[model samples]
Target: MTDLFSSVALPGGFEEVEHTADWAYHIWAPDYVHLFLQAARGLYALLGAEWSPEPGTTRRVKLQGVDYESLLIAWLNELLFYRYGENLGFNQIDITHLAPTCLEATLGGSPITQWSKDIKAATYHNLAITPTDDGVEATIVLDV
Candidate 1:
């Protein structure tokens, strides 16, 4: 029973981040996507979920990376990974941009025993970045 937003390490062995976010978000850098994904995975795993597809089902999850959408998409895609892949889900997600040069996120999904999909991973189709209130955000449309 750990808080999903607890400090965690991102991908590429990032040092550490304050996985907290405000109600509104802004466009972040491009390289932050993978880092966000790693954080989302940590949140999903910490909440007790799987990271693969289910045994038998016919459902697919799609994620579209859009401006400021990457933050939400990254989190949802990870949840989709749990739901479709591991049959697990979360309930809540908390994201944040701690440092002016940092983009951290926290997500929670519920665990279930059902789901279906052939999606191997998230896609960056029609992706575009834009400016936002906080900083720089982008739109990432993913295909589950």
Candidate 2:
């Protein structure tokens, strides 16, 4: 399966891609759990956010929607709310439950300051979660 991806053009890791008017990310991981976690990490990296050394605080997050893509947007938007509302950024995430239309996660991280940029929200533009032989891949576009 890995060899199949090697012969094909595929995103095996997280990276930022060029977009016309918004920030976008290409991300893939070994499973849905890691996929979402990487998405969160990518968002933080795009913001150039600096985290405090403290272990920070932990929070429970839940998002329910009609499908995986919708849930993904909502989950990321919740994280964005945490960033703008509480000045928080998560460095670690534990997905306790994940389904096609719902998810529950425990995020552990710290307060952040001095970001180079601001992200308004995650958008559904070109949002697609495609399954791979070994995992899943998706492109996330953020409204900046």
Candidate 3:
């Protein structure tokens, strides 16, 4: 199926797609690090997150999964958990490595006081990350 982002260029981004029930997002980037960052931003955009002007303290995040898909899901879910559990709104993320089964990142952002929406989890439904001329792309389905 074609999406608004299906033919996007290098240094990619995300777009909302039509779905019967849950929210879906199509995201892409020029590389794995950018792909992960874009996915996080897309998920935050879906939440209608509002942020503070002061950037949050830099924090190290180390995650291990069974594969790239699992890593993606875990990475996104970890961000969501921060929002739900710590009230953070991340920005300026830097991923040092996003190997097939693990990722290490340093993120910067601030605490959130309010957000319009929240997600239940980062799902695996139809999740696939593939290489493109510009870079890698993936679609994420979230439980809202």
- Mind giving the per-residue lDDT tens digits that candidate 1 earns over 18-95? 223211112243345543543344434433443333332232333344344454555455555665655655434444
Q: Rank the candidates by TM-score, best first.
A: 3, 2, 1
User: Which TM-score value belongs to model 1?
Assistant: 0.34
| lDDT, each prediction | 0.41, 0.82, 0.82
Q: Count the backbone clashes (under 3 Å) in each candidate.
A: 29, 0, 1
Model 2: how far residue 139 lies from native, Å: 0.6
User: What TM-score does candidate 3 reach?
Assistant: 0.88
Segments of candidate 3 deviating more than 4 angstroms = 1-10
Instruction: Give the 10-residue window scoring lowest on summed lDDT in candidate 2.
Output: 1-10
Model 3 agreement with the true structure over 119-140: per-residue lDDT tens digits? 8998999988999989889999
lDDT of 2 by residue, 61-132 (tens): 888999889988998899899999999988767789899888998888789866889899999997889998
